[model samples]
Target: MTELVDIHSRTPKRRANEAMMAKIGKLIWALLLLSGFTRAATAGVLTGELDNPSGTLDDQFVYTLSIQGSFDGSPEFPKVDGLDVAVGGKSQNVSIINGKYSHEVQIQFILSPQKAGNFAIPPIKLTVDGKAMETLPLELLVSASGSPRLPPSASGRSGAGAGAGAGAGAQAQGDTPGLFIERKFSKNTAYVGEAIGVNVKVFSRIKVVGAQKDFRYPSVFQVKDKDNQKSNVEVVNGQEYNVTELESVIIANREGEFTIDPAILIARVAVQRRSRSRSFFDDLLGPTDLQEKRLRSESQTLKVLPLPTAGRRKDYSGLVGAFKLSGDLNPRESKVGDTLNLSLILEGQGSSSGMADPTLPFDTKLAKVYKDKADYHEELDAARGIDSTKTFRYAIVPERSGPLNLGQVTIQVFNPLIATYEDLKFDMGTVQIEASGAVTSAPLSSASTPTAGDTAPAADTALPKPEQKAVEVMAKDLVEPHSQSQLRGSDIITSSDWTNGGLALSLSLIGLVSTGVLAYRRKPETENARMQRANKAFKHSKKHLDFAQQCLRKQDLPQALKAAQTCFKDYTGAKFGVTSASVTLRDMESYLRSRSVSRETLHELREVWSALDQMIYAPPLGQNPTRGEELLTKSRRVLEQMERQCGRS
Candidate 1:
């Protein structure tokens, strides 16, 4: 029989691994020697244990009795208080090594608790080689049919969290079928370009055979590099559940309050197969049937705040997280004109996706540096959310031989955790360079070159070299001596200036009057008109709808769905007088709810919105016109509904 499983959780693929069975064979042989087994001819030893110490009222546990070496008649089984025990299965194995035979037998018994209470099973007495032997006693606790209960250690309550099955699941998702989903976010609020750590989980009480799951985030949130899911048994409140969880990082591409849809799971649950009468074979095999269940979590809102403008650094490249910067410069010592490799590794705990390259200060006279594109990759770790590295490589060709410097390479990052900015600097150690390998250049004298009114001196004249000298002034500033006489009469205004100034002022006033009239005439006459009466209402939405239909006809499902969603969003935004293009259906709901919009209108709006949204991300089922046509007709109808509700009393 298949055990309970979550399709959303990570399931280790079981392989035909005889290697593990070989190791178990070795272990069994070691146990034989430890128990003083002479050979298969010797009487076998007996050992017994319960598969699980406790189980729910609706659950069934197992106990196994094993004998090593060899055995006589079947060992007697024991009766437990307040529990029904039945033979679940039986098996045996024999091996002959170097003509010495060894054999083992195992008996499995199914223990079903009759009622919810504590029960103690007394040790079972058995005869091995005609000697009396008794196994140790055991205890089990079965809680009443409600939630599961366990001791503190098994619950792992300390680190897991306050609530078992808490978070996004239990809020609005704890419905029938004993299944729930949870989403743990590092922070509900984050800045733009900031990476938010998210863990999506599903908790279920019922065992499932197979399941498929998908999570749809708002268009504004970009989910990236999801971690491998892990499955575990978690006890929440008193109920036990098989919980599957995974880690992911989301970056808000735009700043807004967007509603995130719940995580969805489609699983095939295992239920007991019914028959008129039960058979013994059904007891061990546990025949069951698979029933599909669709589970969705509660919706949430992620508030993406804009990046802070205060105390921002000039070198900041919109990187929001803790980061470290280090550089590697190859060949510390080289000659001028030699190309050198410089690798700068910028690693951090947050996402560096779409991060621009750092600006390196290159001295044109010293070396011409060419920047190679950055290489980036992320490491996968469950404990530490996200770790990524962005490396910038550069090729430097020296123009002169001297002490070389690449200047200060600093990358500024905003640590959202600490709400602080860090300037990461790369240390470019002093690089010594040898003289140029090839170079030849000489200056031309004034006599040899065509001089510009400058004569060259004779070789024997031996003229003294000119020296630049600095002179100190008596005061910081001194007026020219004859300045009073030079400024006396030439600065007077004439009659021509007065004439030109008056004419210019008249023309400027005339132009101002004409401009004001034009502006007044161009102003919208019906500025306060309803959205339905606006110019871009039905006709504008029609264009988008037409494009969507064309896309659907061409069998471009994704593009068709996208175009349809756009048509709805644009028409709704325009009808509600929403100017921002980023507002989604949920956003519109809140916006309209505040203005006393009717529930019917809101419902209609949501119906169209959700259908388009689900279809856009949904995997292709086939090329079908029903879905596309229905969406187009529904979108058009919603626009009309808004029109009717616009001004009618």
Candidate 2:
């Protein structure tokens, strides 16, 4: 009974002791966790990683050292023997997470193996906030016979299952599809002056986030038609890819065999990492990585054959294509001294760069021909390829004409399709001339004399002869000089009298009258005149529209679009008395609505103006010439409506 009572008495004390010990243990654990968190918050971390741990000797891998925390300066990278190490670049990132600030500095190095073997990259040392820090060492294995193997994440595989599938596929095929380029010509053989199309295409099965290309053709050939290049997505060999195609017209100037060098393309591909268990801090501070790849295409050879020399004509202007020649005389019949305008046009399919002025065999004795500079216009037509036309103007004055025939104009060219030389000619018919009584008034030196083979003159015709005149000579003796005498006082006084009070008074009166007249002539500009001057924007806009039309006729699409846009902006600004630079499309809309512009007119104006703005900012590919013409017409109509509305206002 005493033992039971003692046990009951000790129970409460034992229970209290146990509770106190448990409280003490909990406090100690809390202190430990807090201490650990504070250390982590203050401490810095350094780590090293590899882009690909295993690769071939021909392949290059990236080695990166990342330091997280405050650092004194940049880290010092260590070197390894039998390896080429180059500094790539550096990047820094800063973030504040959960009330804690963190910073990360990453240094990248490109490692190229000189020989096939296992290499060890030593730790990199860095100074961080007056403390020493070092990155962990890394290892790389390079082989000579096998292809490089990228990490599963870098290879775009998600997990172990995907990695296994990739491994099995690689075992089956020995390699994976990669980026490549293909270059080819439309024709392997072409004539010396014929244009051959060349295409450079880049095909890649891998996902490319960014890319740059360097393409070069032989300098010996002339390049044309470069604006036809294209970029888009395509599928090849049952795999999707991004394809960029570059098209150019190449013309070989000389006959020879030439080889085109390979083109290089570099692409930066995004690499997605496999997901891993992370804390809230890590989720907020992860890195995004990208891989770069360089690819090249095979060279191409071309054979340029010389143009045929057989059946070549005398008037062959070194042009190689089908061509046509035409001529027109403004006035077929004119007086002796009247000037006649003659126009000769040469049009063809050959490159205009090689086209020269056509030679004219004019009869100088019949007329004085003054040739002007030839104007050459070339345009690229979507349907007809490249077409060029050259116009030459001549002013002819007939000395004496009756059924006189101006010689024929001829142009020779080699037609590659027909495999022969062609002679294009235009015969100038007879031109009649009436007698001008002012023949004698014409300059004698301006007359054209007959050439060696010119027709003989009529027997009754009289030629002008030089006139000679004789002059009589005579001599006269000098008369006796008058005696010298002193000037009289009265004569001196008379000469000085003009400078007296009367002259001064007259000059002052003239000055006052002139000042008043000048002041009266200079009138102050009124508000009405200012408004009228502002309204001149209509005329200015018309001038811009005219310029746009001229550019459209010349096939200058960029300039035409720019001028058209300027026309509308200037007209709107001037009509509203606002600066053109400050006027937006919305402002124009408001102004038009206030003026009670028709809905149809506003809609048409919006369409035309939007099209013009788009063309000015980003020109469309393969632009049809008709589009420019239509835009020009619409712009003219809108400007006219605005002008009429302004007049009404």
Candidate 3:
């Protein structure tokens, strides 16, 4: 009975062990399968698509192809045969999709076809997982430009419409599918020479492929052949197929309606769109379908009306844009030969570049006017417009006292408001001339001296030379006179008066001779050597300044500094009695001190020289000429002051 009980327990234990082993085996198999799947997912992959290309052989166009995929190994773009390709980026991106690890590599290329015909883009090969993968072939069409084509779908406003819809696909190829073109004017009413904004937009839906792309642009009246200014690129909705500005300065050649010629740019471009479903396979192999656009903006025309000839063209001096002209007289009442300040001010909407010097008609009979001065303030704008003011101040001299009439100022300019050009003229605002006011009363008068006829003179003649005997007798008669009586050897001393008088006279004569010699030495001709030295200093300083000006104009900072250094050296040699080779800041200061130069003046000199040195040896001060010019001006002022103080006159 005990043996039978042991057997039953062992059998149940054996069954439980078998069940556990089966469960463990299944779990191991599942883990192994999951690991193998993960490795496959990490393997390299590549996918791409090429948009269609269509345009004439003579016309240039851009054909674009893009690729997106994953790679465990490095990826490279395979060159497509028979196509002129320019590759851009072969970069990579990483992300996770639906909790699945993912990696992507992208490559882009531009192509321009040489021949016009049906063309096929060969498969692009890339290496991944040490294996090569390729993109499928793409179909392209190149059609002759200006051919009759189907009309584009009537959709959005301006064909680019409100939002991206079917229009995005249709317009992406080209806005205007047909060869029709039209011109539009922003406004119908405009004056002669008035700038009329016009737009010539072309629409087409043709596939374009090549190196050069197509463009459409706005139109302008009295302008032609602006096709070269067009630009083409993609936009948010689809593509902006347009060109830049076709600018024209309206100079009214005639008085009637004038038409502006149509501007056109024909090109080919690739068109593309997103795929319906982004499956893993599609992501690696790209979407099946690729779309493209090839189109041209049609030529446009614009009408510009001429200025009105009926209205009183009176004071119109061809002044355009809105402006306010006013004149003011300074000291309204002034005498003849006295200065009368007449100022004319014109301020309004215009480019600072366009502001011309105004002409004021002053009565030459009443006053002689000189072009005194003119001041201008202007703000230039690349967009919008410009605002500026021109002020002219005239120095008028009255010839005679009377009522003077300053003639009316007239200016004619295009009126954008009225759409018709108008002339503005104003007559001379009258000014009353008065007698001169005496600033000082004439009180004392100095009488003039009479001429030769009025004045008498006494006759004069030279005295004859005294005889030798007379001189000897007189000397003896004055015998006891000082030096005469002085004993020499056996001669006895007598009058001291003769000796003193003779000695005094001899001293006076010697002093006069010395004075004459001193006067001769002080002549201005003697200062020629010093003048030459001073002039040399000026020329040297000037040379550097001139060189600095030239370099500054050319925007060469390094060269400007070198020139400035030369200037400083020359200035030092000529002005301070110091050569450039031996001169230092300390030496300059010491030299200035010896001359008793003002501290402020000395500081200026030191500061300028130091700045020049720093400019030459250190990094540039923003712009070359500007910084150098400021330094040059300061140096000039300082050196001039120093020279004056040093008695350089």
Candidate 4:
């Protein structure tokens, strides 16, 4: 039994030794594989080729260079020493597959030989993992477009041509089609305010994954699509591309061909397609076939024809583009002192779309102009093309009239579309007017007499009472149903006997209840109280204002505006009873009016708030600071006026 136990222990020890040996063998194998990969990295191999002449001057050929090596250490592309590259010259990236690593690069050149001759592309060297690899030199034969020594065409075939036919079939499967580009103009004829649409497009049959970097469009040509209009991206017919269009105004500036150049897109794409592997293990251990192809798009050309001058006008003013003119009269017919509403709309495509404000000519002998309002709207394409409209409104009162003529409101613009000078002459047609006789009143001799049809001039002694009556009437006429309820209640309370003993009792009770509130709201008795309130208000306002400023800087006008409004409301709610969201200009006006604030002060305050709201929500002018300063001045003046008037309330 003892001998059996000894045998069992000996057997276990032998098995353990065998297992340890197997593990050590695996470690050795792993180390050897790693060393092989490391050695392979040090071998840098570079490859390059020259364009095979296609015999056509316009035909573009692509040249690709690839370098494969292991950067056992840090590696970068070898810098070219003495070569002036053409348009799209160099692109490079490091790639690794299986145990092999490579750095790939490409370039483009527009080649036009001075004369038919032999040419050679110089050899290039690649550095990988500290070792240099030299690429073979490329030689090319330059030939005329119509040459005779070319290879035989497939027209001559026979029973023994099977091998050649198969080779041709294989080549066809790997062949790539070339690229084409074109530029187009919408029209050569246009009137003033017409949009001259221009488009640039690129077409290619080569499979392109993406651009190495963003492609920059040409700069010499200006795009009328301001604000990034006239630009679009679309996938059409299984192809992806970006297009830019410009709508230039047809201004008859020079009445000649005004050529706008096309924006070009040059891209570098991988020529070889990635092949499929047999299995997961093959994918991890096999070498990938490396091949390359080159392609380029044809250069684009655009023709801008000048607008016709056959029926042109001398006062054309060179405004060429498409547009619509709209106008309206407030009171087509009115009595003297009655205001006439005049609105005109000029919207269209052109250089002056957003830059020009239309002016209306009026006859001062027949009418007196009071006030005018104008606004502009513009739309842009790509980042440069612009389409715009402008509207003007005016209040004109007939001073003395029989038949008043608005003459002609002439709008001048350069039409880039028609390539001619043009003008828009809008006639106010003709307005018929009759005199409104003066309003006369009969003499009255009563001490105190009031009538429903009374038209007497307000006397000095009764001015206050009559003004009060007018205010009451205006309030009743303008207020809504809900507000009317509140007004009625106020009226009832004011007419009650609260001015007598009841008022005294009520005042005593109110004073007792407000004593604590007034004290709490007063200048702090404790240092911490004042500091805490000021600090809280400051922090809240500053945080909101900072966010508002950021949004404004980003042109997120809506959010910036909301933040500004919130800041004011927050500050007021914390310091006073007014919440910004709940308060409005009208509310302030009513409060000031009740407190007997001066009309000038109230008007200024309303104007300040209204201007701020307009600037925040509406289209902005070029200088925001100017508008801001105006707002600040008005705000300060209104606040000072409010403080002076606060004591009175």
Count of backbone clashes, every candidate in sequence: 7, 0, 41, 48
lDDT for each residue of candidate 3 in 90-189, tens digit (9 for 90 to 100):
5344545554455555555545556556777667666665567777776666555443333333342343322322111122223223322223443444
**Which portions of model 3 show Cα errors greater than 4 Å?**
1-27, 42-45, 52-83, 130-132, 146-356, 363-400, 409-424, 436-649
TM-score of 2: 0.49
Candidate 1: worst-modelled 10 consecutive residues by lDDT: 166-175
**In angstroms, what RMSD does candidate 3 have relative to the true structure?**
21.1
| lDDT value, candidate 3, whole model | 0.53
What is residue 206's positional error in candidate 1, in angstroms?
Answer: 3.2
Ranked by TM-score, top first: 2, 1, 4, 3
Give candidate 4 misplaced runs (Cα > 4 Å).
1-44, 49-65, 70-118, 125-133, 139-179, 187-195, 204-223, 226-252, 255-263, 268-318, 321-326, 346-362, 370-390, 401-438, 441-649
Misplaced by over 4 Å in model 2 are 1-34, 38-85, 98-102, 111-180, 202-213, 224-229, 238-244, 266-293, 313-315, 326-329, 377-387, 436-649
Q: What's the lDDT for all of these models? A: 0.67, 0.68, 0.53, 0.49
- Please name the candidate that would achieve the greatest lDDT relative to the true structure: 2
Q: After superposition, how far is residue 344 of candidate 3 from its true place, in Å?
A: 4.1
Better of 2 and 3 by lDDT: 2
For model 1, name the residue pairs that clash.
4-207, 5-208, 44-70, 147-238, 148-238, 148-239, 169-181
Write one digit per residue (lDDT tens) for candidate 2, span 168-255: 2121001114555555565677678876655555555666665555456676787664555467775543455566665556778889
lDDT leaderboard ranking: 2, 1, 3, 4
| Clash count in backbone of candidate 2 | 0
Q: Which ten residues in a row have the lowest lDDT in candidate 3?
A: 164-173
TM-score for each of the candidates? 0.44, 0.49, 0.42, 0.42
